[model samples]
Target: MPVTTQSWVVTQRLPDLLFAADARDEPISLTAADYRALHWAWSEAIGDYTRRTVTKPGDKLVAFAAIAELFQRTWRAEYLAGLWRPTLLQDLLWATNYEGRAPRPERYRAPSWSWAAVDGHVVASLLDDWLGAGVGTAVQRCEVLECEVVPATPLLPLGKVLSGTLRLRAAMVKATWDPDAQLPVLYAALDRLEEATLTSPPATSPAPELTQIGCAYPDSTEDACEIWAVPVLWNKAEKYAAGLVITPAATEGVYRRVGCFHSPEPDEDPGRLVWMLEQKKQEIIII
Candidate 1:
């Protein structure tokens, strides 16, 4: 084994700044640049921490309680499972970083919407390089109506969660399985995603010419013949939208997130897909 002396001046600055910002007594409204920087820092921390191999898969959230506590105190915001409440919508858009990934464990860890629900490297899609560069803004298209995360230990809200529920008011439409669909991005919710075909026809026409506008990256590899798409963010300039793919739970109108869907509607006019989605907006709960 060889010991190497490394320069640490540059590496120390990030944490120094992070803690300094956290030490503030009051939360300050951040500018676009500040927000980008903050988002980047949190994204890196989350991605780095979750990617590490752990002896017990169930210890995911439990192991990160310390960081979560710091985040809660700093932002003075609600912590939902593995995401922050202030940016819950954007945070819910995390996806797997590789293909042919393993299926989720049978034992419950976290809600399907949370990255802690699955094993592997998951990246926050909204915090990608494009957002950092400010190329196109991610317009939030959904609203989180209600959220609840019951911790196993009542004294430790940031510790292991017994259960969670996320309810949203957003545009949702049925998506059928399409094995022949192509994936537009390398990092998706799952390694092998089934093509998502819209079951409902577009408002513009009685019959839609193109049904394969997106793909569903499920949380698990189990067979799913049908799912639902709920649009979360839209970048009108880029003709792109990112959202969740869900399936109905035991209770009607309630669903479980099976995966995430990324739709790049380059062929359709900007806002056209959004318009279609708006027509089908409704409230649904995810557990």
Candidate 2:
């Protein structure tokens, strides 16, 4: 059995890790290398929890897994690559929060450090600002997102958005394509049940509504629509360079998927994971 180690420094805050780290008030400065380790750890942890469910609007509760996955793919991935830092963060913070506050905006006023009101989604918003940049290859690619997380339109900043209420039963509602036909369009509703209630399935069935989120990718309207679905299903999506996994569902045919992969299997020996992908890219073979 392979021992799952936290390869990401930024993303690796397990339930317990957060508590320990939060003990310190000041930022615990880490080197670039340390940050990458945290990023890998965080990605693995986030993927472990949020990979299972799909959520829709008016369904009850939003799919936190979807949001968590977005965060890891966004800032955590780039931070791991060592591409973003104080400079990148500075730019993002300025554009998103301090843009119009001209002429020593600091003197006049400023937005709260915590932009969120109800949900403590500061982590999510920070990830968005840092990761959401560029065009072409820079576009984010992941499944479940069916839309993109647009930064500008919301009334409150991302750091301070809410899912209405926490009292509502948590779950993903079903999605129907043709209402009369009652065709199942797949809304993979998995509840993040409480530890005490895992023994039983949800009491009320899911009744999801159709609403679009801006950050996720839109469904393909091309001849190769099914081909696009492949990228969404691939478990390890962030591994791809285009932020997309190029594959298609086939009955019994082999396909060549376009992608850049990191090392799938590391040496048994304990070593750094930063170069693991680059050094072991060729060693990884796609079935």
Candidate 3:
């Protein structure tokens, strides 16, 4: 003799339950552990839910919750919990506030530098304030040693990223934090100074050139940051040579990509920038 349940009543409560799924008593920081979990989740989920599908500002949270539910039974409980942490949720919302239509990778997936790579919350370094004048060569060249991914399925958005590796020939320099910018700033000495001209127009002045770029480290919460700025050929025709920024992880010789930094200034020929960096290219891996 059990009471019969009403379908309408259950339907009415569904929205409330979904919205309440992420309620928390306190905020949580995006720790190294959290970042690792996030990276894995993103690699698996982004293919199913393209960044282009996110239309509204609030859609990101809704999408995140849905993805978390899909992985609830498979992933560790702690890893799923990190996704809903109040601070992390807020950061995701802030980072996804792009004005125009999001960029979609022409290939099967999003590019590594794209937020689409990991459609989750992102937080910059908290210690960027103390950054002052700095000098040193950080990363000279990079090679994608290996990249592998499993095909996607109905339940899984992106199959699974089996293993990925990057080989970098870097100088490795301690970075300074720029508090105002809330990101680590690195001043790296560029190789082949004459090559720098490839990215810029005919020189108007002989100014001492330095590649000043912002860097992010996935798992690090340290004030004294170590970063590498590896040149990438983002667009050959536009002559766009982007800085694929990365930072070391706990494992020796292992690095996690932070993001890419490109100069805002217009370049007439971006292909030269790619050529300049390609001089050191060894191998390319499609992720």
Give lDDT per model, in order: 0.65, 0.24, 0.35
The residue-level lDDT of candidate 1 at 214 comes to: 60
Task: Write model 1 residue lDDT over 143-213, tens digit each, in one string.
Answer: 88899998898776777788899988887766666422333221222212234458854354233333454
State the displacement of the C-alpha of residue 137, model 3, in Å, after optimal TM-score superposition: 32
Tens-digit lDDT track of model 2 for 1-287: 11123323323345333333336655455555554454444434433432223232111112232333333333333221111232222211111111111121111011111111111111112233213332224333232211112222243222122211101111112211211121112221223344456677567755543321111211111122222112111112232221121233242332212211111222221332222121212111112
Candidate 1's C-alpha runs over 4 A off are: 1-14, 21-32, 126-140, 178-210, 265-271
RMSD (Cα, Å) for all candidates, in order, is 8.2, 22.1, 16.8
Per-residue error for 177 in candidate 3, Å, reads 7.3
Residues 1-287 of candidate 3 have per-residue lDDT tens digits of 11112311222323222233246444334455554454444443433343344554333323344444533323324221223222221112112222222333223232243343444333321211111012112222244343333323334333222233334332232233331243444455444345445567655535544544333333222232455555532333333333445556556656554443442223422224432443444432222
* 2 versus 3: better TM-score goes to: 3
lDDT for model 3 comes to: 0.35
lDDT, residue 56, candidate 3: 42
The clash tally of candidate 3 reads 10
TM-score of each: 0.76, 0.25, 0.35
Candidate rank order under TM-score: 1, 3, 2
Candidate 2 matches the true fold with a TM-score of: 0.25
User: Candidate 2 local accuracy as lDDT?
Assistant: 0.24
